[model samples]
Each structure stands twice: as structure tokens, then as C-alpha cells.
Target: MYKLQLKPADKMPKYKQIVQSFIADIERGVLKDGAQLPTITELSGEYDLARDTVEKAYRELRERGFLTSVQGKGYYVQAHGDTKLKILLVFNKLSSYKKLIYYAFIEALGDQATVDLQIHHYNAHLFQEIIERSLGKYNYYVVMPHFTLATSQEEYLKVLELIPAEELVLLDKDIPELNRQVPGVFQDFNRDIGGALDALAKELERYPRMTMILPSDDNYPVEIDRGFRQFCRYNDKQVAVKDNATDEVLTPGTAYVVVRETDLVELVKKVRQTSYLLGREIGIITFNETPLKELLNMTVITTDFEQMGRTAAQLILEKKRIKVKNPFYTIRRGSL
Candidate 1:
């Protein structure tokens, strides 16, 4: 009586289940060295599973040295095998979420597994090149698709299609619409906005009116603006947003929120200039939390980009054990 059970509902394949069961028995000392194990056909019949499934289980056990098979003889138990794992964290920036994710990933993985991170900027053509260059350097990729959609490019989506779907764990963005068929760990903008708003509310006396300056043509920034506007509207605060391709809404209030500084630098600079011209101070907040934003005294509502990187690595390594289809995490830092 091996007492091993398999559940078909589990996401891991049936063969892997059978293989793990044998390994567990071996590790528990129930299956001793040189103990004659049932033949693949016999196990197949007993479990009412396909013969190929049973053979795959035995083959994996043999490959891992947990079992030995002689050409004409039945399988025999041997030893437990090492189950080391490896992961790769790929991101556009080495920001807070990225740093936090890196450290947390290393800590969570501990000494058993190794994690390697690659910093890739938001360049579609460069990403396409990197995809071809790093064909088999690691077991899995934790990708952050931070390419500026303003370029009307989906190179990352193409890269996703080129890579094995199961080998990727997308973070901070979604490519599901691309139909790449990969799993994801989303950075919940809605949840993040709620947290940022709560933090902003604490500074109610410091700022009077809040206005969002969104990128005229970016999905991520647009989503954040929508969430922020919804939050303000929910609280009965007047929602002031910059219309796409329109310069009519750049008027000063109290706060100016942006997604990407690169897209709206001129506008931000203009606002600052106008403020200086009028001798008034305006608070600013932007996404991605880059060093340029830090150089200024703008109140920031940002994600922990470093932690995001590290956690992306952790999630990819632990992906097999996750029960949820689309898991998300949001971390709040500073205020505006």
C-alpha cells in the first residue's frame, strides 16, 4: 500500500503527480533501496491511467535516480533527487519595486535556488534583439512590459509569442489582449490608486485641488488616471483631467499627476515655469518613480519598483504552486 493519491484537478500534469508520489515515498523511507516497484503496465492498470502516463512517471523517476530500470526487469526504488529551480527577472528600470522585488526574491528563494535579473530599457527593437540573444540562459523569465505604447508598438507581445508561454510571468502590465497565452502577476493600478488616494487624503490641508496630467496616448498611464479620477469623483471632489491632444486643461490647481515624465516633460516644465512666474508652488506626482522625479521636490505617489522586480522573480519561481489565474500586488510609496 503506497498510499499515494493523485488529483486530476491539480494544474501540474498527471505524470508529474505520479512521479512526485514515488519521490515522496522514497524520501519517507517507505520505498527502500533496491525495492522492486510495479512495472509501468501494472501501475497503469492499477491506477486506471494511461500507459504513457505511468511510463512517463517511471521515466522521470529513473532520470532523477529515484528509480532504476533494467531492460527486461521491473523498476526499483533508489534515492530522492534534487529539485533546484532558477529564475530570471527582466525589467526596464531598477526602481523601487524592482529593487524590492530583487531582494525579496533572493530572500524567499534562499540558497536552494538562483535568481538572475536583466535590466532592459523600454525599447521595442532592443527587446526583440534581446529575445533572440538570450535563448536558453535561464529556466524562466519574469518580464515587465513597460514599453511606451505611444510608439504604437507591440514588440513585447511578439517576444511573448516567440517565447514559450509557460516560461514567462508578466509583472506590472498585462499582455493578455495580445493573446500570448502567458500567466501574469499584475500590478493592480486600481488597488494602488486607492492606497495612493488614502495617503493623499492625509495631506488634505497641504493641497487644495488635485489634477491628473495623463499621457495623451499610453494605456498604463491612462488607466492610472482613470482610477485616480474615479477615486476623486467617489469622494465628491471635482475630477480635473487633461484631454488627449488638447492643451486646454494644463491650468494649475494644487497637484499635477503624470504617468511618464518623458511624454509630458515640456508640460511639467511649463507648469513649473508658470508657477515660478506666478510665485505659486504646485505639487507633482508621476509613475515609474525614476531618478529624475526624485531630483525635484514633487510629492510622489509611486510603486516600490525594486520590490516589484524581486517579487516578480519570487512569483515566477513559485508560480506552479499558485492557485489563482491572475494574481496582482500593489505597493504604495510617498504622496502627492
Candidate 2:
């Protein structure tokens, strides 16, 4: 029989603590492979825990490949310490919002799985190389492909061919070429922008014109432009869509929608230099929320990144091969 200790003050349940202690002992060579474990009833009595709690812990250990049960016999250790699920997480870049997603994903997975996170920085060549190198190396591959406008769908499909579709979980943007073939958690960009604009329709009426500054160099989703146009046309509002704000003049009674952070900074600087009262003489709406944006009191259009992470983790854990459209909402601050 193995000696087990339970701490009543510990936040972890007695059964889970037993599981962790057993795993730790096994890793330390105290519990050798093929070693027999105490019976559930015996462990329950030893730890002063319920029989069901010990049984549940044993069942979890067996399911995680830490132990094996022999019919009409007893439970034995199947693995010394290799019981963690290996996951490969790939991202475009690590931004504040993406950090939220990554942390949420890690929290949702708990200690049952180990994740190796890598960033390709939106480089197509690096993306291809990383995916090819990671083939067959992980149990699951979660990819966030921020493909540029220049990259063709065929190029993406060819690179994705390296991984089995069942083992892949695409994140953020959705590719029409992949269609329903690959499982993913994607944002409905067009719907999100359009809905956000509609929600702010009453506030937008306060201004005579709205201008959307879209940088040509940035790889913003095309749906954003389409959604902006759709909202402007549908509402019969005068709107100007420009590639950059460099040449445009900032006029009072006009709202500016900026995408990139640098552009937001420039616009804010311009507003302050001219002494335009924010949310009154001129309005600002930025894409994606961050802590700094909150300090500026800027309204933002954003998707629930943490929820996206939790949903993605759940899908991977459940092995569900389905596409989920993440939720999006508008945060109203002093800017709007």
C-alpha cells in the first residue's frame, strides 16, 4: 500500500491532490512503472475521503494513460510520467488581445495538456516552414493564419495539406477555399462590423459625415471595407473611405474610424492639437480593444477574444470538427 497525504486547507480537492501526488511520485521514480496502486476503497479510507472521490481520481488517471485497470485484478501504472497531451499553438503575432486569447486557452486546458506556442509574425514563408516542421510532432495543431492579400488560397491549401484536417483547428479568419473541410473558430468580420455600426446608428446621426481610414500597407480583412460600405449605403450617410489619413483634412462634425494603433495615435494627437473635444466636435472609433484604448476613452469594435479561446479549447478537447463563429460587440466610451 502507498502512503497518501491529504491537506484539508488546500484549494484542490483531496482526490485531485492524490492524483497530483501520485503523478509526482511516479515522476520521481518512487512509483515505478507497472507498480500496483492501492485499491479505491483502501485509498479512500487512508485519505479519509469518499470512495467515489478515490474512484473518480483513479478513473481520470486511467483515462489520461497514467494507469491501466486489469479486469478482476487491480489498477497498475501504465506510464511513469508521460501523461500530458501535447498541443502545438501557432499565432500570427503576440498582441495584447492575442495574449488574452492565449492565456484563456491555457487556463481552459488546465494541466492536462502542454501547449507549445509559436508565432510566425504573418510571414508566409515562415508559416509554411513552421507548419511543415511541426507535422506529426503534436497531438493537435491550432493555427492562426493571418495571410496577406497577396497569398492565394491555393498556396494556403497546399501548406495546410501537410497536416491532417482532423488534427487542425483554424483560428480567427476563415478561408472560403477551405470551406467546411476544416474545423475552425472564426470571426464573421462583415457581420460584426455591420452590426456594430447599426448599434451606433443613433450616435452616428449626431455627425454629418464618417470617414474610415484604412491603411493600404496593413492586411486588414476585406470584409471590414465591405461592411463599412454596406452600413453607409444602407443608412444613406455621407462617408469617405481612404487608404490613409495623411492627405485627408479632419473636419468638425465628422467621425473617424481608424484601424491601426499608430493611426489612432496620430488622430488623437491631431484632435488634441486642435483642441477638439473628444466625442463632441469629432468622434473616434478604433478596431480591437486594448488597455491603452480604455485610458483614451475610445469606443471600439471588437470580438470576444477570451471567449474565442475558451470555445476553441473546448472544441479541441471534445474533438468536435465544427466551425464556430465567435461573438463580437461594440464597446462605447467617450470617443463615441
Candidate 3:
């Protein structure tokens, strides 16, 4: 019999507890190879756990090849195998999509193949410090280079120079003049902005005179501008560009708003609150989704953060097997 234990007070999540217990049991050989285990329903009844908990744990074990299920039957233990490798997940400012990506990544890595993992949050000077310390601690370094206007690209490049590019994985943004050794799975905004524009164009037919209000800083808003311009050219629309709202030349048309993290939101709040700004029949769209998008009821082009994380992790693991660079890109989701 397997000792299915549950700790109510532990900070570790319940599903993870079930996973750790199952792995320990398998390694101890108490659960012999090809041994038939209890059905999820049976386990749930025995342990007083929800069925979802048991199912998730079993699915994890199956992904790692620790167990296999027979049709119309229960799961059985598979032969013990070598443990998984260690991989580090580094990011700045965790979001919903990013969390999703991390979960999916763990799923794809499989329990057997991934023995260890570390998550480091990059905040201000902490990002640089973590990168410097990570060189020797982790076998694989997956980085999300999310630079704000305050972060100097030169300073960032100095840190990038330290990691062997081959062992490093870049997620979301790109580092210019990067050495070839770094393998990057970057977020593709070109396609995303194009798609957002297409969606906006369809919306624009109802609301003419489209105006794009993009917040600017460190070329982040520029790529989105390129896409919006490309689509506008494709559809025969003219764009009036400006760095801030004070210079905004809003005519009778739908306004496409692009903003940077700096002062973009405040500008929008001013525009919304001020009767003069909101009086125009302007259709709005943002490059990155924000509270303003939801509050103002504007269209949004966003990156599938969780998917990006998962794919980056998968690419890193895949690189280990094939020794070939697995490409990275972004998924564009358009919404109101």
C-alpha cells in the first residue's frame, strides 16, 4: 500500500504534495514496476482529496513515464528512470499569462526529465545581480530581458556578455549586439501588431479617422508603430504620430493609442476625464493590454505570456536532446 500523505499546514500546494509523495513512493520501490495503482476515484475516496488533485498527480506521473494507464482500467507504475535536468526561469513582473506559461512549461518538461527548477524575479538592480550569480548555479539560463526606459541597453549588454549564449535562452525582448552563443525565443511583435491592426481596421469601418496613441520609450512602442503603419498603408489610412497627448492632433476619426509605461496611463486618464479628448469619435487600441484598455473599452493586442514561458522552457529542453537551436516567437491575441 502507498502512503498517500497530505499536509494541511505546508505552504506547498496540495497538488504538488501529491506529486512529491508519488515520486518518493516510486523511487523507494515500495510501488514495484508495473504495479497497478488505485483509480483516481478510489484514491480520492481513500485520501479524502478532490478528484482533480489525484488526476493532476497521475497525469504528471504519466507525462514523466513513471506510470501508464490501460484502457478501461487504472494506472500502473512504470520502470524507474533517470531524473530530469535543472533549468532556471527568469522573468520581470509576473503576470497572468506569464503564470500560465510557467505552468505549461512544467507540464511539457515532464517530471522524469526535469529534476530541478528555479524561478528568479528580476526587479531593478536585482535582475543584474541574479544574472551574475546564476552563471555557475544553473545548467540552463532562460532569460526574459524586459527593459524599461530606465534600464540602459549597454548595461544589459554587459550582463549578457557574461553568459555563454549557447546555454542562455532569451524570452520576449531582444538584446542588440548579442553574441551568437545565446539562444533566444523572442516575442514576435511584428506579426502581432499586424494582426491587431487588421482587427482594428475591421472596427474602424464603423468608426473612421483612426488615430493611434502609442506611449513611447526605448523603441518598445516603435515596433508596434511599424505594424500599425504597415497595416494602415495596406488599407490606405494615414497616421498622425506624436510622443505625448499635448501634441496629439486628433481629428474626426478613430484614434489608435500606443503608450509607454511612462505617463501613458496618466495621459489616457486625462484624455478620458477631459471632455475635449473624449469628445472625438476616436477608436482606441493599445499595444500592450492594461487597465486602461478594459476601463476605456479599447481594443488590445497582447502576448500569450504563459505560452511564451512554456515554449521557452520546451525550447531549452529540446535543445538538450537535438543540440539544435529551437526558434521562439509570440502569439497575438486581440480583444476589446
Candidate 4:
């Protein structure tokens, strides 16, 4: 049946319009397989289409295996068009976890989606610009709203409100101010780090003093420091915090909670050149997991990055509007 009007003002070309409309109907199941389409003559007459225009549209549909022609009866629907999602995946920065999240996301989506990945580099102005320019261009907007600027929370929330609530999904960082208006898969940095330390309390007894290498980078979450301090206070353990670890004073009986990979390398190199054994005299616990850390048998507290990506992809596919806390765990290895 004829479903689209002859909108001459539409920027889309006439034949393309006809092609797209049918494809949309097929994907939506409004047009079913074996269903008969109106005769080209009938469509042309009723919709004011040139005979060549209708014929060309039908030919394109048939070439795409979406239509079949009967010599006497006219055209009928062939195979149904699969629903293909066009998603805009936005992130703040490309860190080590980016690759894992990206690969897992695409692998889960498979042939059902076209993901357009973009980064706003944590600039508030750039973030707003990207969202504005991409408006109405994607079926879904998946974003990681991690900002480093001292801008008020209201500013960020206002920017997010620009996106339609139903079409938006958040990743990585969760904003409690949103009041559950949208769905997200995020990490509880404070609770996660604190809980990990509490879980390893017995193992930590080997070292009476503990120090955290927390660089003064805006990107490094402040919640991590809070969590560490909270855990130490509750456990009655001696604790210290330093901004740099390159020349850190490594005490003989103290354990270290290292944050940066660069810092970890420096500390490990420093330890290897000393008398303290790796797991006995001195202990190491890193923030995130890596192959090198695994090889060195270092304990780590990390979020399930691959699983986070898969969960985000599932949310997009199902168009779900529920919040999920990604799993976080401590991988106990020889270093601890």
C-alpha cells in the first residue's frame, strides 16, 4: 500500500525517499513478507509520481532483495529488513581501558550496529558542542561524562538534559544529581576501592604502614583518596598520601598502593635494586589491571571493563532505562 506522500520539498531525492520509507516499514514489521505492494500505476496515479520514478524505486527495492515482482499481480514484499542501529558513542578521554571497552562494545553489537565514536577531551565547551552537533543524527547517544573542570554540577547536568532522556545512556561516571532520569553503567570509585582494601585486611597485616601514590591530576578521582582514608581510619592502620612516587621514601615494612603505571614501573625498578623482597618485605597493590601487572604477579583493584562494555551494548540493544553498577574486584596476586 502507498504510505508516503510526494514531499517535493524534502531534501532527500524522490526515489531515495521511496526506498527509505519501505525499508523503515520492513524493519518495523509494518510491511511483512509476501505482502502485496500497490501497483506502480496505482501509486503513480494516486501519489502524483512519475511512472519512471515509481518503477525505479521498485527496481532498487528488488535489487536489495526487499521486493519481488509478479508478472500480473504487481510487487510483493521479499525478505524483511533487519533493524540496524546507528549509535553515537562519546567519551571524555582515551585511556588504557578505552581499547577494552571499545573492542567489547563492537564485538557484542556485531552486525546490528554502526557506532560512531567521539571524544570531547573533558572540555565543557567541546562536550556541549559535540552533543549539539550530533543531535537528531543518531538513534542513541552513549556518553561518558567525566569532566575535569571546576564547573558547577548544574552546568554539566544542564548539558546532559539537552539529550532526549530515552535516547541517552551514561557510562563510567555516575551523577547522582540526574535523579535517575536516564540509565547508566558506572563505577562506584569510593565504595569499590574502600571495599577492596577491607576485603584484603588480613593480607595487609604483613605491612604495618601503608602509603598511597595519588598524583595531583584532576583526572584522578578524589573519591579514591576518600575511600583509602576511610578504610585506614576504620582499620586503625597507619597511612600516608603523596603526590609523587618517583623519589618516594619506600619504608622497609610499608606497603604501597600505586596508581599510575609510570609510578608502578619506577617503584618496581627501585625495589628490584634494593634488599627488600617483592612480596615479603614490601607489598604492592595497583589500581588497574594490565598484562605486565599480571606477569609480575601484582595485586590490583579494578573494575570489569570488558563486562562494562558488554553491559552498555546490551542496554543500547534492549533500549533499557535502568541503572547498573559494573562489577569491581581485587585480583589477589603474589605482590600483595
lDDT score for residue 95 of model 3: 56
TM-score of 1: 0.52
TM-score of 2: 0.74
| Model 2 lDDT tens row, 84-167 | 667889998888889999999999999878899999876778889898666655678899978787877777777777777877
Model 3, C-alpha of 177: deviation from truth (Å):
2.6
lDDT by residue (tens digit), candidate 1, 264-324 = 4655566655533211345565665556656654455666555554555556656652312
Off by over 4 Å in 4: 1-82
> For each candidate, what TM-score against the reference?
0.52, 0.74, 0.54, 0.76
Give the C-alpha lDDT of model 4. 0.84
Best by lDDT: 4
Model 3 per-residue lDDT tens digits across residues 1-336: 566756677687777888776666566444678889888988888888899988888898899888999998878989675334556677665655566667777777777344233344444367677765554434566777766656666777777677766567777766557755456656556666676567555555654455555546433535666776777777777666666665554444545555553444554555666454342454455555556556655456666655665666667766742222223222222321
lDDT of each residue in 1-336, candidate 4, tens digit only:
557634567687788878877775665455778889988889888888899998999999999999999888789988555557778899888888987998899999999888999998877788898987676556788999888747667767888998888788999888888854788899988999999998899899888888898887746778889999898888777999888788786777788999988889889998988999988888899988999999989999999999999999999888788889999999999987
**Candidate 4 colliding pairs:** none
Deviation (Å) of 276 in candidate 1: 13
